[model samples]
Target: MSGFSIVNGIAEITDPAIYENWLDNEEFKAAVAADSSPERNAVKRLLIDFEADLARMVRDDRVQEQVVEVMTKYAAWDYVQHDPNAAGNGLEKLIEHFRNVPVVGEVSPPVVSVILDGEVACLMMRKPVPDPVVPDTTYEWNILTVFRVHNGKLAEHWSTFRKAVPGRDPLGD
Candidate 1:
């Protein structure tokens, strides 16, 4: 097991593995859009795409062109990050932060649910954390990240995360 599974896409946010998963899976998309309007639905899709893009960058080379491409597609140039542990504001700071990190061995942490209101979207994730008291044991920690979107691109971000030890990024960095 890769310690990751989509849970049959409970909230229907997991995109497919190798194909145009979301677009071809009408039933799955409908599950996600079941109680939403067209506008809110669009925001939901954008957030999912952004999440998947970040995950892809993790599995691939962090310094490769994909970083810029993915960020450009989903983030505004004046992106603001509010994570206290993050180095500084602006997109490059965030990009540079991951440039030299070793390749991660696990997949991105699964997102439990996604919520959207107006122009703000929140991705709720149940993170896996090593149990401090019990060696080799892990626990699930709930983490919430909210983003303010502009023109369908993420502009500002806030996350519930603290710095981890070097090479110990729980979400695969």
Candidate 2:
């Protein structure tokens, strides 16, 4: 069995081997379902809505202003530090980065998980890389984002990404 359990009303995924196996394991799935308290539900909903907005932006090539509207005025987007165009910083710069850059293909919806402890929520998701810029070659990426939500809006965000080697899968298998 996957070493997933609950203690003091918090879901604990003890086994690193089963970290990515929760989606398929019935026990883990049931545990996640049972731990969906009201606060967690709200954070989940917020992430879903944010993803929908991002998808819409990718599909239409237009910025959805309402998505940022829900964010705090001083929302700290840790992901943009790697973006060259975000030199000015802040949400507007991030929006400009998205607007100026060209998206070759659709953005796939990420697999999201949320963990809530008291007033803090940790949201984790895996997103696929966009299509390659070069022809006849494919380079894939797996991006994981963890967001800290406060007051029902995104307060802080952090992300890490891994690129698949050419002619190999993300895991280099």
Off by over 4 Å in 1: 1-30, 33-35, 100-102, 127-140, 164-173
For model 2, name the residue pairs that clash. none
* C-alpha lDDT of all candidate models, in order: 0.63, 0.48
List the RMSD of every prediction in angstroms: 5.9, 9.9
Scored by TM-score, the top model is 1
Compose the digit string of candidate 1's lDDT tens values, residues 23-45.
Answer: 33445434543344777777777
Please give each candidate's TM-score.
0.68, 0.49
The CA-based lDDT of model 1 is what?
0.63
lDDT of 2 by residue, 61-147 (tens): 554453354333324553233322233456666555445444434444333455666545555444333456876653434444566
Query: Which segments of model 2 are wrong by more than 4 Å?
Result: 1-35, 64-85, 117-142, 161-173
